[model samples]
Target chain A: MRLDLFAMALAVGLATWAFRYGPTRLNLSNMAPDSLLNRFLNATGPAAIATLFVASVLPYLEQAGGHEIPLALGTLAVLGGFAWRRSVVIATLCGAVVFGLASALV
Target chain B: MSAPADAPVTATPQPMGFRDGLTAALPIIVGYFPIAFSFGVSATRAGLTGGEAVMLSVVIYAGAAQFLALALVTSGAPLLVSAVTLIAMNLRHLLYGPALLRRAGKEASTRQAWAWAFGLTDEVFGAALGALARGKRFSEPMMFGLGLGAYAAWVSGTAVGALAGGGALAAYPALDAGLGFMLPALFLALLLSVLSRVQIPTIAVAAVATIAGTVWIDGTAGILCGMVAGALTGVLRRPHAS
Candidate 1:
């Protein structure tokens, strides 16, 4: 019964709903593909994902201490698995397995 | 399914209906379960109650943003800052509906847009776009079915995972550590799925900016800097040239 966490959830929910539902109402179907807004929106997905990926991995890299090899191999397994199967689930599972096995060996 | 030989011709294929949409959502449901479970595990690990974890899934429903929210909350970040950062991280969602509608073209009906649009997650958007590209007619019932299926899977998966409790994986030290890699791996996989020559620069710039910001300021500041810097670079780049 943490009121604060519930409150945060509701607030984040409302804002996310607005982002999801608002644009459909605006009817921006005619927006030029090259418009700044369009381009920014287009680029935002990859850029944000890239940002999150780096932000998440950096801390782990910083604290690798003795886990660097496992970490590196796990990342490579993810890349290799995705390149081969083109499935996020498979790739992530592969990476986790590599990470786990490497951790045991290391 | 192929059309009957005697079916009348039309510019668009017949609507696939709610059942088909649910069927189409099978892959998404499979994909979402593990991630949603991870989120639930992470949420409880971050000190949120099981109800709170499920509530976050039931409400916010954005996978990556939920992970980010958990991080921010655990760090004792200001509430407003957490909310704003989550919103910024999800801003790409604003483009999904318009992009889908534009692809669906003038004949598509958005009269029920307000209701169906609420389910336009990245994967949902990708699924819908893929459906349209396959020449299927758009229908609100189908969108409803797809969204409902994914939403149910997410919320239910979270509940189950939360019940597994925060330390459910603690006994498996390797697995627990590996779970930490899941988010980064997931994000990277997603980015690669949509990678393009045109997008390389934006990604590189964003990655560099995020690293710099993280080194000098903090993770949150780095995310903001990366997003703004990468987007601006994208705006400046010519469409045909990288």
Candidate 2:
């Protein structure tokens, strides 16, 4: 293993640790008001939807590849699952399974 | 001097329990698995060892940014350049932290907040926020479950990808190609769910603006431009009523 890669990983882990664990120790969560919290919650859903659109759709249309059918089918399954069950886990599993099966067939 | 010293402390209503948090976070975990798998595949292609790839997943943890950083580092970019570029890419986390602080505060301590901040990916933030919107109290165990599940999936996916890339590549050549489409497809599904008339147009404008900017300035600048455009659109559209 390259020493540099190891060093980089260690640095990143430490940084992440500090970021994830530090604020709680400092009690910063108590500082925010209820109105602010409400706003944050409201914003998250839209942002998530936005992110999903970008991450999933843009690359597929922009990049040509053989896996398009499976990708489409898998996505459809996920969407269907979400509609039917309103369950994220089910939707995701459906997508993954469809992708895997389609890949195997092709 | 005048306030009552023995005012009763009202108990905050707990949101869904740890089970619900884990359930809610499942989508993110699923979404991250393939992305992390791709990262491992790329790492091996970039000539890193298996141990190195796993380490990357465990340590760096920022999927898209880490992949971009790895490419830059491998291309012989200066360490300073890579570092600065990465920080810029991840600056969105600053917004994430402050937002999360608002909702999960009553149950979260400074240490817990820091931990949550570390785990604050786009997906986790979304899940937490979604839960709260439904009037759920943001619980620590739920957040931990979500974070831990994502972490495990990422690390495990990387390991699987690394192994496949090393020797299994010959048997499962299509695995790599198939994995490539997962992100775009996933994103599309997400977009479809979120795209209202106002938001879709705004996103399109932002995407086009970013693409155009990339043609001129290049690199991560496009992402920033896109974000700014989206933020402006969001602010402008806020008064129209949802």
Q: Which one wins on lDDT?
A: 1
Per-model lDDT: 0.82, 0.60
The worst-scoring run of ten residues by lDDT in candidate 2 chain A lies at A33-42
Model 2, runs deviating above 4 Å:
A1-106, B1-35, B70-85, B95-101, B104-111, B130-136, B186-202, B213-242
Predicted candidate 2 versus true structure: per-residue lDDT over B1-242, tens digit per residue: 12256966546554555577677767777767777777777778788877888887777776655665566567676665555445434444445565675765555544455464567665677778777777667766777777777777888988988886744555664565455544444444444545566565457655665665555765344544555565455545544344
- Locate the minimum summed-lDDT window of 10 residues in model 1 chain A: A85-94
Q: Which stretches of candidate 1 lie over 4 Å from their true place?
A: A85-90, B1-12, B236-242
Go through the candidates in order and give the clash count of each: 0, 23
Q: Chain B TM-score of all predictions, in order?
A: 0.89, 0.69
TM-score of 2: 0.61
What is residue A99's positional error in candidate 1, in angstroms? 3.0
Q: Report residue B236 deviation for candidate 1 (angstroms).
A: 4.4
- Score residue B58 of candidate 2 by CA lDDT: 77
Judged by DockQ cut-offs, the docking class of candidate 2 is: incorrect
